[model samples]
Target: MVGVMDDNRLYAIGEVARRTGLSVSAIRFYSDEGVVPPVEVTAGGHRLYDVHAIARLEFVSTLRELDAGLEDIRRLLAGGLTLTELATAHLSRLDDQVRRIRSRQAVLRTIARQHTEAEQVVLLHKLAGMSDEDRDRLMDDFWSEISEGLQVSPDFLGLMRNGPLVLPDEPSAEQLEAWIELADLLRNADFRREVREALRETFSGPGAAMMTSSKMVAAFERGGVIMGRAQEAQRAGTPADSPLGREIADAYTAYLGEIAETPDSPAFREKLAADVLDIERLHLESLEEYKTSTDPYTRYQSLVAIIDGSARQAAEFMPFAWLSAALKASVSP
Candidate 1:
């Protein structure tokens, strides 16, 4: 309608029909449905399109392929549904569909292994879901049983209990899988007993009380960073035995000394040294069962050597060597 009369570029309904394969009546119905608006009408009152209608028809065809209802398509075209908001909603629905499909695939995979139908069904159920509360309770029970027999101060036990595996109420498939694995781990009596034994030793030692816990944590944090640097310097050929390690050891010992009521007592430092070494030895021996003769680097063995050989030398010499000293300080007037 806005075109120059002499210009022959304007398309009539028949041309649009040929171009888009949509009947004139169908196009008219779409315009009425608000799927697309006409460009204009001619003076003779005939409907005219200026190349835009073909594009609109193609868009409508694609929407129809996607099973979008006509009214929904109309709202989309009318700007009632924003592209971002609409795409996000569809994507969330698609994700759920994908999760269900993957769960079925896992069941099929297990069935391929000649599992019984009941077993397959159980596996699917295990894979499919978990509630947040179930995850929390699983961790709570594990940590509680581990800490129950330990004389570990109340604060340390509380801290361990708080590190629960938090899962969403509507978790993704990956999260569900992790939850199942974690729950299975919690059910293992060997693992539970291992944790209990470890906590018992750590709690029975000199740093069992709240203040000692705080100081040890601070020392570990401070010492760990220094330990990393010291090892790096030694690895760089700085010294056969870098004083960096010794310095950190000294700093850790000095920190314990400052807080220790018996900083100057040689007997206390020597006792603390023996205690630290004994704890490391116990940690190593307990894990020896899992180590292969061929693999010299078990986790516990490596950790003990690293801490014992390096900064832990001073760690062994912590000035606050006696729990009785710490207790007396706590009750002092």
Candidate 2:
């Protein structure tokens, strides 16, 4: 029952508690904290709240149940804050928490699968938290280092530089694992050296001079056309020593000569045939490394494929094989 003094009605602490479902002690504490101060106090120091104060206490109790801080409730009660602002802040906090939780899940999954050390776990956490820009920058630095003083084809170098693991807003365990492995591989000094040497031996050596020439762009375009013809011939199962095969081979050799800035000759054909054979050997060795050796470049490629959905079928080497045979058959017996 409301107490009456001078024809004004007010609620005692116990009465407000009973109505609002807050404890008498909680109402008293809220009053003490000025979050819901009482409207009156008697000579006996008993607290009493008016209808407006009791309503304020009810609202404060509701806010408390919703996890609002006392200071925030104070501001809200004092009309210095709006519900929209509070909701936005809480939503932002929830989004951050969700991201952190997902990252933790990914890291734990990685750790469980790998049975890594504590330091490794720490590193995993850092990797999971990396921003997209930071991730791209890390890969960019890696590509820059490996491509330094190296005349890599623009299209090929662009592929290397542009390939970055795009972690989802909530990354899956597998995605995160792939990203971690790829990042570690990219940062590896030995892996960098391995790639640099391999690129030089495989790509930079055979066509290095042609790529450096002023007409290299035109040469590459012309080579593409020549290679396209060779690929078509191979696809049709044309015999390497057939007239059509020889005709395409003549054009292919001519394009190579133009790129090499030399005339087509018997000596050039023989040397190039042997050089192409050596290239095949190098390619086989590299493939074997991917299959059997501890070298992680293959792992790097696989991880990138996972991240970017570029994990298509393996490159068809039949074209190279056909071209090699055609090059050999074009030589005078």
Q: Which candidate is the best by TM-score?
A: 2
Extract clashing residue pairs from model 2: none
How many angstroms is residue 143 displaced in model 1 relative to the true structure, after the best TM-score fit?
2.3
**lDDT string, candidate 1, 65-181, tens digits:** 665567767677778987676667666767777766765554455445545467446745563454557756666777777767666555545544434455443444444443443
Candidate 2: what lDDT? 0.73
TM-score of 2: 0.52
The reply for model 2, stretches above 4 Å from the true place, is 1-25, 49-55, 148-152, 163-178, 190-333
**Model 2: worst 10 consecutive residues (lDDT sum):** 309-318
TM-score, model 1 to reference = 0.45
Each candidate: what lDDT?
Answer: 0.54, 0.73
